[model samples]
Target: MDDCTDRATKRSFLAGLGSLGFIAFGTAAGRTSAATDSQNTDPQPGKGPFTDSDEPEAFVDDVMAERIGTTTPGATVAIVSGDTPSLTKGYGAADVDADVPVRADETVFRGGSVGKLVTFTAVMQGVEQGVLDLDTDVNSYLGDSTVTVPDTYDDPVTLRHLGTHTAGFESTLDPDIVADPAALDSLEALLTNQQPSRIRPPGELVGYSNYGAGLAGHVIAEAHDTTFEEYVQSEIFEPLGMTRSTFAQPVPDDQPGNLAAPHVRDGESFLVADDVYINMRPAGSLSATATDMAAFMSAHLGGGAVGDTRILDAETAETIHSRHHVRHPAVTNWRYGFHEYGNPDANLLGHSGATVKFTSYLLLALDHDIGIFVAYNGNPSEGPKAVVDEIVAEFDLQQAPTTPTPTWRSGGQERAETVAGEYSLTHLPQSGPLQVVDLLEHLTVEPADNGRLRTTILEGDGRQWVETVRVRGGGRARCPGLRGYRWRGGRAEYE
Candidate 1:
């Protein structure tokens, strides 16, 4: 049960998997024919669609071992582009004590909140079928009147709000719910019973709520006259050809050969999850391989058409990526389920998922017909962000910089007066200004190695708020907390 022994067992298991299947859909003739059909069309330059090269799998192994050597017993990773370009790889162990080796396509890691996208898709399908309206009051679909809505809200709670995390419902996955297994028996019970706190009124602000999405799932189940699990399986999973995906609690023991054991950090040790079944099933319960998830993303990147199957219309898929509502005053670019970046040139949309031991991220560029999906079966500290950043850079997938100025500030003396001022964070639209609460009297603005102004905010009481301000396009400075602020127009009001 020691950490080292546990890790070794997991590594051995992941390394012992047998041969894996790789499928190639289009033939040379088919590719040629498709290219010929689009001869008159000019395709834009894209970063990838990258095929896995024979770079020593050593690089990936080093990454996995170094990052999660202490916490995760084993791990796996799979990346895919369009139908033709793909890379499926695995490393580490499925279970440390069991000595199960992780297989690329075979290992089934918890999808976590990635399952929300599945539920979101199902809700959208209900919208398309007229069984559910995005803007309709959810009370109609609920069989019971246990859940209550605030009277101050003029607008009704719609399926759209649930998908976009704007339902204004408080999250019920608190300590009590986590402690009790049966607390998740019904969504209405969880919602109506949980105290109501009006967070910016429904649809006005976007705050992530597992309670809101699970409520939507319950509504969908009632509307279709079937269990939420069954409805999603038949309508979404089966149609998208995700044979391995499911919402079942604890996943079926006899179902698949590649089930990834969940892990958690216990002080200096990483142990298996104690309570795997919590109330966030609708928000985070899902399991699948990269191959299956790629199909889901393929359908999205392919304009809602994966091979011969079309689960959603192109327009509807586009709308899902569109900004429905803003989430936070500080993070204005976040909308609904997707995070919006203000750079007009880089129109990317996607969601990041984190569970007890896994972190997954999926991003797609509608204009470029490009998509990327990443899944890691370890803690977020296992370097998922670095891997994602590298992928984005490698593919050159990001939009062009809006501002042309180099990140470095030119030769200049540290000027406290020049930089000191009240600035508005304007990257994301806001109702009011973001005042710099304290600008140190003896503060200085200096150029960091990266072309940006580093302002040292010092207080007479010895407190400090150091901020790095990067110039984003249109004479706007990108400040971390304050977002994009006007650089020149606003005058400094000294305290």
Candidate 2:
């Protein structure tokens, strides 16, 4: 990866604190983060046949600059292809108070829910080795006669449900773990005390549950007769050659030097959060560098093989990316560990992670064998999805045939300002909030580049309520009500 200091001029964008602030925190089960040496190094170009050239670098620079100005004290981004990383850049200070700058390969941040992917991989390995079965009831492996499912759940919760978060288990870890770093050390006792619920029948619907993942990790530990941390280290990390990755509590002690401090917006400034540990290691407690994560992404993209090492068979890897169940029928595409973007014409699969202060995303183009990993040190007004969409567009890395870019007429700033407002989901009320949505009409907007007259809906509710609606073409905006509902897409709808 190239370490570049050629900074780009900052761009003015939306700003805020907490959920209103640019923090990216997903509630999924696993988490990961880190920092490294800084030396002036040339940007290493992508290994894939297609290269993004200067466009991607410029785009990345703009992103980092925005985060530095808005949320994080420092930020590190690593973009890689196949076996080699293309870009690794750092911006701002790693320690704001100490004024320590972030290094491309050195700075580490929380992994957030990305660690769940690793846990999922570990479970799959056990399944492949005949040590576990995906279809087998999880209670069989738990071997606890005292533990029983609620009578409400007619179907038994299996390993598959647990792995895919369909087991209906709910996480009960103390929320104060963010404030108390040592809380995670007593995870087993906590899990034992707080019996999770089977709110829904197993495999009935996809409801993300950290408890489900932690339970799966627990089951793996029991089946292998070892601590979950040790089992993951021995079976997954070591084999994958992730030298610096670990599930250690009180992070820096486990893997020193390369740790990225967590950041939270304090007033108009960004400050580091107290070092927090997760007792639910399986769901969100792994720390790794961008390079190490790139290796993991490469393995997944390469069908479970990083170079000559085959961590999983091609078939098993394929299973990991495939959609295990429909999460929300109206919510477009939601899959097992990842979500699908685009329709039958084009699709990309990946998952995004966020902690209190950091936002990260990993996207893979399965057909093209291309993948991208992005991690930011601080929060941004825009989420990581914006970064992913921009990179893919700037690089022309879509799996399907390319479509012609549409021409957009710039509507005056007044129109842009008029359309930009927070919108709530009436149908899916629980999906959180959306904010700063800019709507455009009859514009062939490319990814990464913002357009004018674009009526964008900043969903007050974070749920992606509008699916299958054309954002560019002139159609009725089918968005949920509460608006100057200008003509952009089709008429907006509630459900």
Candidate 3:
């Protein structure tokens, strides 16, 4: 584990998040304490979780149409298994102001962080072509002249490190991300101009780094001598026939009316998110139809090919799916661009993404031969809680262990003050001078009884204390009282 010499820094950061009216955690709490505490009633545990025994008829549809719609204005879902897609459906209004309903086949929504999966797929394909090496120092490619990583030591960041999120880059969140299309910067220029700090030694810790993914995209662009979007379009999307999918900003000229407008809930209206351009298109902002995403899911599961259009060699595909670095052995690990969470063998792989208004989730249950994609055009606290996790539970992908309160001798927190500190998400970018958010986002830990520690999170209105019921290894705190978010090395490792 890394040194805990920065405990006061950690506490100040988390305490800051709690002080910010607890806005982040409030975004995902969902329903009430009574509802979340209910036992699992899925009889098959294999077929579905929200079955008739647990809820009303057409439980999945009910959630998409009613529960999710209560917050998000529009959403689309696609479920594919084996050779065919079992479901491709949409719910609620695409444009509440225009009275247009969402359609799974026609409307497109931002895929958010799921786009990283597509980006890494291309990176792996390039590796197969012998154009790049996963273990080579990435700076050697981007060049010490253009982008320099200070204090890299013996082991510099590599493509594999970037894919597994162990590259040790601190987060960088540019508040001006939401800008006009013309105002956005090129991937290379952005990487060179606003390079992130290497907070940890390479391959030392698994902190989700979007900056690393974006940097990888830039490296790919440099190698191909083309824009990141163009490389992905010509190599991956076109081959898979994801015609409506795009990484380009400004929605492109050809796909104007097709892309769904961003929206958020108002009392009775859906507020249209302003036409703000996203700068980190490589990190997120991939727009595609649910039907198109299914094709992607199909290709990855089909040994990196859809029909005969081979995207990556079968061997390369196998390599990407294999575990590269495992943070937890029994639980799961990171496989190239993907990380395992819910499955036992860690066969299932995917990502979840979000912006101010848009949220998306993608899961590939390879063993089950099923791929699921869900995206909503509005920001809702329960967007993922009710949509993704519930659905994953239904498929019974893997038997993930839950941290229940142990009755044994029990571990206690003797080094509470030592462990108490703030952790900023490695996935997000840490603004250089704009320290407000970084301060507010800090997660503070304090000692508590029963081996528990009081932690603060940003959610809903503001900051509040969330006590952890159990403390795990590597200075990690498991809040069984909450959603079982495990924090180690001053960062949230997994949920």
On TM-score, the leading prediction is 3
lDDT for model 1, please: 0.52
Off by over 4 Å in 2: 1-49, 52-55, 144-151, 170-178, 252-254, 327-334, 342-345, 399-495
TM-score, each model?
0.67, 0.70, 0.76
lDDT-superior candidate, 1 or 3? 3
Reference-based lDDT, residue 264, model 2: 62
Tell me the tens digit of each residue's lDDT in model 2 across 1-495: 100110110011211212111233421111112233322222444535344445445677766555464544665666655655556666676766566777766666667667777888888888878899988777788675334445566678887777665575532322123457644545455556656655445665444566676777888887898888899888778887777788767665656446776666666666666655666677676777766777788888788898888888988888777767653322234455565654323457766555556666677777656676666665555656567777777666665433333334343233334334433221111222321222211112111223232222332212111112223334322221112132213432111
In angstroms, the error of model 3 at 114 is: 1.1
TM-score for candidate 3: 0.76
Which candidate tops lDDT? 3
Q: Give lDDT per model, in order.
A: 0.52, 0.56, 0.64
Pairwise TM-score winner, candidates 1 and 2: 2
Where model 3 places Cα greater than 4 Å from the true spot, the runs are 1-57, 143-145, 174-176, 330-332, 343-346, 400-495
- Error in Å for residue 389 of model 1: 1.7
